[model samples]
Target: MTSSTEPSLYAPREPVFPRRVSGPFRRLKWWIMAVTLGIYYLTPWLRWERGPSLPDQAVLVDLAHRRFYFFWIEIWPHEFYFVAGLLIMAGLGLFLFTSALGRVWCGYACPQTVWTDLFILVERWIEGDRNARVKLWKAKWNLRKWRLRMTKWIVWLLIAMATGGAWVFYFTDAPSLARDLVSFSAHPVAYGTIAVLTATTFVFGGFMREQVCIYMCPWPRIQAAMMDDDTLTVAYRDWRGEPRGKKRDGTTGDCIDCMACVNVCPMGIDIRDGQQMECITCALCIDACDDVMDRIGKPRGLIDYLALSDEPVERAGAAPKPIWKHVLRPRTILYTTLWSLVGVGLLYALFIRSDIGLTVSPVRNPTYVTQSDGSIRNIYDVRLRNQLGEARVFRLSVSSDSLLRIDLQGIPDGSDVTVPADSTHLQRVYVTAGPDDAAASTDVSDLRLWVEDLATGDRASRATTFNGKGN
Candidate 1:
């Protein structure tokens, strides 16, 4: 049995009501939320004019066919290095931003932040501002509260559903999938994914907003490693605003302890308490405090973006260094240089990639078969990949330093093989060496198998060994 006298490990959460404030930071947050949400919810609907062989969606992840299409670019399974490079670039970019600006990604561009902001906006519209929300939370259960809560939840569910639906649309043709979804004829996986995502999004955005950032996310812990004394982050100027009081006496600091910064915090922590892991550095407190400062005829920036390296200098009544000086340090430079190198390499590879691909697999069960005409023949299974949208004929040929001849099993002596649009065709290939050729008769001979697109004249080759009768 649990003892009531022992301190409880879990503390009951006190819901935070972030009061609305207007300033530059608030406007910036609004714009960022709009852009990020717009991109997420609308990108799947954008169309591109690919040929009839491919989906018209501008961005698609065709898992069934193992293709990723982005406008003019098509990524095959073999080209997954491009995806890896992109992920590496993203990580480097995240590190660069964290070292320079401290959790700016979490504050402004994270999907969690964006969606939570959206949910909060909806709540405010239905239940009024911060004070009204607190009152509603404390008031006794009644019809008005129930109605408002239900209305807000329903809106949140709709948004969550839309979010899930948009994600699945990226995997297939959007319009067809949408029709199937509406008709209840979509795949069971689609329905299940949507249901799961909907539940998580609704819960995360609406109920567990700040808790997710504080406890669930690992970034708050990992960010400490990425930060340094020069990292610019949201901070309280305790030197200028300390020794708190209600009245502006000579001994009283600028703080006045009005609780404006605390009231505006989404995470329900006082910024004046110094930096904490829970802080996302959203800078809404800056907006709130600045408004208070303006009203009371005091200087702004009681709460602002500051670097720890500048604190002592600023406290001694000297101006801090410029923004670029903090941002262009050695660590950031290294990240930028590495990020640029990877980007350039990816671009180079994308530009130089071939339109046709060839892979040759030797059939070694019988090794080499001796022909009736005193010759040795090696058999190979050659796969020809056609990347173009239209069907094309590919010519096959073989070359070796020694005497050798190539032949395709079904095609006539000189005729080419036909491959369908954007597909791979496996063909049987035979490389023969005459009895008089010493290289093939005694040992394995190096052979180069070449394939050429008859229409585009693009060529690719694979190197294999032609086994000899003696070996």
Candidate 2:
């Protein structure tokens, strides 16, 4: 009992079988895909010799030890600001690229795009090209159809599994994890992560494909704000190709109505329909249209990269502005400056950072303990972090306006504490003030706890409050 004029809230997805075409853009995409996939799969296996005690994996997120190691750089839990700065830089870089060349990240280097391209390559291999795939899709299920589908699915599953496997390798020692995985002795969490990633990759890349870009990804919606009139994007020249007709009569437009652009589109959307959110700016349509134009003895660029501001100039049959004009504009320049500043800041911070770390937490339950010798004592838990490759002796010292004495519980001399290499050690510290001292009679006193590495003479300090008995 549905009315014929009623709107349908849901529409079934139309399958897209993109025809293979070779041009500059297509070749560029092939190179990007190969390089990106190679990096993703092989980066975890690369070894970096850190030390005898440290892991040799070049890039690892050691969740067990709360550390992130990338080549020679190591990040500890306390230094999370470094991670935040990198993420900010990444965001700014995305903004810079999107402002200069719209959605270039999504088109060229996005993980989804790379994986989807790989899945399509496999699909085109097992089945035939676009025409063959379309026919096979519409035809009844037979033994040949079953065999082709099964073959494609099996290959897709393998790729997805490998993708998942490569991801987990980044979290731990790759060789050890691989051995554990093979022997079925790895943690259940690892298996769960792999299974989840494999399923998502297979479904998103092979089945969902462009749907992920069109509906699932928020970047498509957010990219509009990041772009302006000067942002270069994939576009069709409706002005030149309008009145859609072949070159039969001398007065007809350039378009032949061959639908070549539509046939090669991975999103199954026509480029001639003008800019749409579904367009990833992949420039595949540009390649397709250029091929058609060359065959028909017409000039290329029936569909190509164009900025909105340059459309008027192009429409008037004049040369458009230079590429640098569009890319080096105010908005892009601002983003670039910000990105550079962040990068430089992070580099400066990394280089100037100290290897020694100190944390002081005062035990406040019994704020001040009065000793039998008429002295005020405060307890502190001091954690010393040794970032060097080997163990070193760290000497403790206390400084204040008033007379204060520092003592370590276990150390005989109460002066030196030895922390293991690349590790933190917690030591109990006692600060005592004689009854006649001004700090012992005051309510609160400023205290500085310092730890100096005896080997390197490098020092770190923590400023803390020393509780005192009120007069």
lDDT values for all models:
0.91, 0.92
- What does candidate 1's lDDT look like per residue over 121-186, in tens digits? 999999999999999999998999999999999999999999888899999889999999999999
lDDT value for model 1: 0.91
* Per-residue error (Å), model 1, residue 395: 0.6
Q: Report model 2's TM-score to 2 decimal places.
A: 0.96
Off by over 4 Å in 2: 1-7
Question: Per-residue CA lDDT of candidate 2, range 301-406, in tens?
Answer: 9899999999999889899999899999989989999999999999999999888887899999899899999999999999888877789899999999998998
**Each prediction's TM-score versus the true structure:** 0.97, 0.96
lDDT of candidate model 2 versus the reference: 0.92
After superposition, the stretches of candidate 1 with alpha carbons farther than 4 Å from their true spots are: 1-4
Candidate 2 displacement at residue 376 in angstroms: 1.8
